[model samples]
Target: MEILDPQNTVLTNAEVYNIVVEKKKAFSSAPKDHRASPALRTVIYETLTYLSGSPAATQTEEQIKSLIRALSPYKFTGAEILQLINLRPKTAVEVQLVIEECEERLTEEQVNEIVEIVKQNFPIQSETKNSLEAAEG
Candidate 1:
């Protein structure tokens, strides 16, 4: 079967999740005897699980895309945006750890902006842990 990405380009994890789940639904409605092969079913299950990110990162994906685009002029891959949405880093160090492979380092201000955007959507749990550490230290 020839598969086409809806965007006519590479898909992000969330987009992949939507497409896979939509296909799964279509398959579910088909005649049971005509359903996907066992191997394909297993692959679908694993893909769903891998893309099912934290329930707390509840912002609509369009919002996430907008946030990622805000970092432009910096140029991030779609995979990086997906990981950023899933991980929700809360500081410059955390953002660096996520996007370290980018050709250029983000300035402190830029990292802070990205962190703030992420925190607005999904505050990483580790931020509280880091806050406690700062208080205790």
Candidate 2:
């Protein structure tokens, strides 16, 4: 994919999940003469579970990519976009905190755009909603 960003980057948790799955497939299909490291495979599986959460049931990698595209105009880096996916920030203040390290400051409108995309793709459960509202209030 021709992402208008630096190399060696991922745009979302789903992309990371995809990488882990591909690695598992590669290790399993390796020639008998070429044994894969069990330790490394274990790490990949752990990371996948950590990054995926339960959102994998609803959001696909392509949907994550579409979210990234929607947010591209805000000029966030791929790493920042991935963080947005993982964090699923629902408010402008929350989104701002997540992207606080960015060199470019986003306007309130830009932040809202990101918040909208995240909410549309990764709807939070009622428990999470209550917690977020309590924290924000």
- Candidate 2 error regions (>4 Å): 1-7, 54-58, 101-110, 123-137
lDDT of 2 by residue, 1-137 (tens): 34465485455555556666777788778896675677886797788777545454245667777777888787777667777877778788778778965426876777777788888766664655566669989
Q: Local error of candidate 1 at 47, Å?
A: 1.7
Which pairs clash in model 2? none
Error of 1 at 64 (Å): 2.8
- The most accurate candidate by lDDT is 2
- lDDT for each of the candidates? 0.68, 0.69
Output the worst ten-in-a-row residue range by lDDT, candidate 1.
51-60
- TM-scores, all models, native as reference: 0.64, 0.60
Model 1 ranges with Cα > 4 A deviation: 1-8, 55-59, 73-86, 101-104, 121-137
Residue-level error in angstroms, candidate 1, position 129? 21
Query: What lDDT is reached at residue 5 by model 2?
Result: 59
State the TM-score for model 2. 0.60
